[model samples]
Target: MEAPPVIAVVGPTGSGKSDLAVSLALELDGEVINADSMQFYRGMDIGTAKITEAERRGVPHHLLDILDVTEEASVSDFQQQARALIADIHGRGKRAILAGGSGLYVRAALDVLEFPGTDPQIRRRLEAELEAAGPAPLRQRLEAVDPVSAGRLGDARRIIRALEVFELTGRTFSSFMPAREYYQPAVQIGLDVDRELLRERLARRVHAMVDRGLLEEARRLDAAGLRKGRTAPRALGYAQFLKVLDGTASVAEAAEETVVATRQFARRQLTWFRADPRVSWLDWQDPGLVARATGLCRTVPVQPLA
Candidate 1:
């Protein structure tokens, strides 16, 4: 029998991607592989909205809580791990459901994306420069050599990475960008959301997170070295709540800030996934959303892998 095509449920945070992934997994005899970078860390449950054990309804989930709060989540490493899990699931005659909203990580798992090589020495030097002089100098330098990447990249870490790639390969980072080609037989289902409703939903969700002890979780992880983590510390709710711990922000203030940041992040997520023409979008709130998504999975023909 032919293996089932991988089904990826994707969208902005709070769009109900996780719930739909579980429903599809149950209906299709599939297991889920999380692609959300923030969900990689252990002890980040409340803020990340990680699906609880009971919520999973006995369907197996992979790649959740696989890293300590202090460990960095690497896209290349995730590419290897997610791909291996997909192959293993298929070999066992089960479908592979890739689920999450992390755009680059999703592309890494299913798209023909090539990650640039990194030199630690060069990276460290660049990081040091970033720390000493801030992003202004680094952004200026990147704009000089790789204006496309410079214009696109806004974070310090990515800017440093682009510079490192340039130094190592003597090629602009943009030159290494992959076309929207899938690495395997797969289907991407995006949850289409109403921007206004999602904004309100995100605000309520952030408040609910706070009521559910997001501050306590953040404090626990902070003591567990979340502050030392390169990526984990920057997560929306945790970052805002961490400020509450430091006496710089109140619980209400943190919750409000988190809501704003989350809404902004969701907009960016929509932009990223919408740019990829291959994704089939479905209304997140439709009564037959699961049925529609499952039909998409069954009907889409998977091309032969090259």
Candidate 2:
């Protein structure tokens, strides 16, 4: 049997990944499976830049708005769900279009990384250390134990989680990284855009999110106890708005901060995807982006099923 073709549309935020995915899906009889981290939350529409019903253009989308604001969604969780969704879509004779800006989630799904189960004792000790000494001490500990993993994971929460896994399982989290060869037959299409244009679009998108009641969404998450420092709450807009809500920053200050953070995040995403040789980078702003992507899709070499 031939393996189903999977096309992944990936890039930094504000790079028009979703638009490309929607266009490709419409033209190719594809169903989109979201690979974004925050787009999973049920009520995080505006901040996540989630595709509206009209934007979907009747193309089926999976994995968006599937989780609650209070819940934490892991890369492993996404991998399982996305694989299942893609298989189902293929079974129905449709292509699977994986799309989003979350590099880790995308890597996990495509590479089929083996994530270790959580250990409560290790988690408790880490929690206690965080309570007593804050993230710096735990970060220092992780740096000492696993410098490579420490260097790769800049986010404090991710670093600590890696440390927790190491402390509990007595193995490096990096050791569990799946080989690149594990991915099923796939084509990775990365959206590229001008930096200035992306930044301007990000600023405008942030304001549009505010106009669409992002503040109200933040308030709702705050009411659900998803304040600063929590994993689920540390997502871009929510974390910045929480600072505003707590009076540590003005609304204007929060908006500025959010834009800066999101731009930095976009840069990080670009770095991540660039490191992968498999991705075929495309100019997202190109007038013929759809045609180019469609051409690539049609020409992708098929592979034998496992």
TM-scores, each model vs. reference: 0.97, 0.93
Clashes within 3 Å, all models in order? 0, 0
Clashing pairs in 2: none
RMSD of 1: 1.4
lDDT of each: 0.91, 0.83
lDDT string for model 1 (186-303, tens) is 8999999999999999999999988899999998999999999899999989999888999999999999999889999999999999999989999999999999999999986754
The number of the candidate with the highest TM-score is 1
Top of the candidates by lDDT: 1
- The superposed Cα distance between candidate 1 and the true structure at residue 124, in angstroms, equals 1.2
